[model samples]
Target: MKRVWGSFFLAMSEAIVPLERIHSLIVVLRGQRVILDRDLADLYGVTTKRLNEQVKRNRRKFPEDFMLQLTGEEKDKVVANCDHLRNLRFSPVSPYAFTEHGTVQAANVLNSDAACDMSVQVVRAFVALRHMMINHKALSVKLAELDARIGMHDEQIGEIVKTIRQLAAPEGPRHRRKIGFHPGNR
Candidate 1:
């Protein structure tokens, strides 16, 4: 029995999503990286309608933060941005966007071996993106620090140059012109 279940799971997990494909499916919306329901359903080996039905049945599992219904404008933008999502442009119902947590919850709600395996892939994809963002953030911070240091040095150097120029100047008694017309012998 164990061997049979193990083999079944292995077979189900055979259809793996390429890491790049998964990464492409993740989009930033409302300041959160999320996968659209259609894309996620395709990855999980289910119809979009079926996936939505499950989400509706287990409504409590998905909160506003985890899943969101896209606005018409946002939907239009998504469709325009992704060539593969052109079909969605004609879809009357706006698609749902699932965050990382929502993806895991969806897998659980789906209760299938494929969903389980694919959820892991989804999580890994999100994590890989997060790591990249962190690396970029660190690099930016380092650049800002270097720029500040250079700017401080530049200011100091300018002051030093000004002082040197002042010190190198020749001091002489100044001949001043009288401000008002000086009346001599009239």
Candidate 2:
């Protein structure tokens, strides 16, 4: 059961981002390492401003942890890291911040049944992906250990082969064995 889950986890990690994008209806709503308002809007098929408006309207649903505005420095960093954001035309003066749940909350605020369903599915996929990443990291560590052991075994095997070759080599002069012929009797 554990192994099955681990395998499923690994597969999910490899697949999450790609699958999320394919669903198109479900956006990542986050940046490389952080969730930004613009991303949420893009995923929810709303303007960035509209997304913020919905959050503002339902302020109680989102505390600081659930949603916040991105700091200038964070926004700048995001722009720096993201090629799409590098262009001035698409870049916003400010961006909002939200956790995964914030986006889910946005779905509710929008009151769209489709968005709600997509959000739930996306969240589940993300969770599975996270599990897979953890499993992959563990497997990578194990693989490193196995590689080291295999390298050591290869060296040991080489030494053994060398030793066997030395033993097989004729070290001393070979004496011919004399066999008496029974030709006369025959």
- Top lDDT: which candidate number? 1
Best by TM-score: 1
Model 2 poorest ten-residue lDDT run: 1-10
Per-residue lDDT tens digits of candidate 1, residues 56-75?
99999999999999999999
- Candidate 2's residue-wise lDDT over 89-148, tens digit each? 356467776666776788899776555755666676556666777999999999999999
RMSD of each: 8.7, 12.1
- The segments of candidate 1 whose C-alpha lies over 4 angstroms from its true place after superposition are 1-12, 154-186
* CA lDDT of each prediction against the hidden true structure: 0.90, 0.62
Question: How many clashes in each candidate?
Answer: 0, 1
Q: Residue 25 CA error for candidate 2 (Å)?
A: 12
Q: Candidate 2: where is the Cα deviation over 4 Å?
A: 1-34, 87-92, 161-186
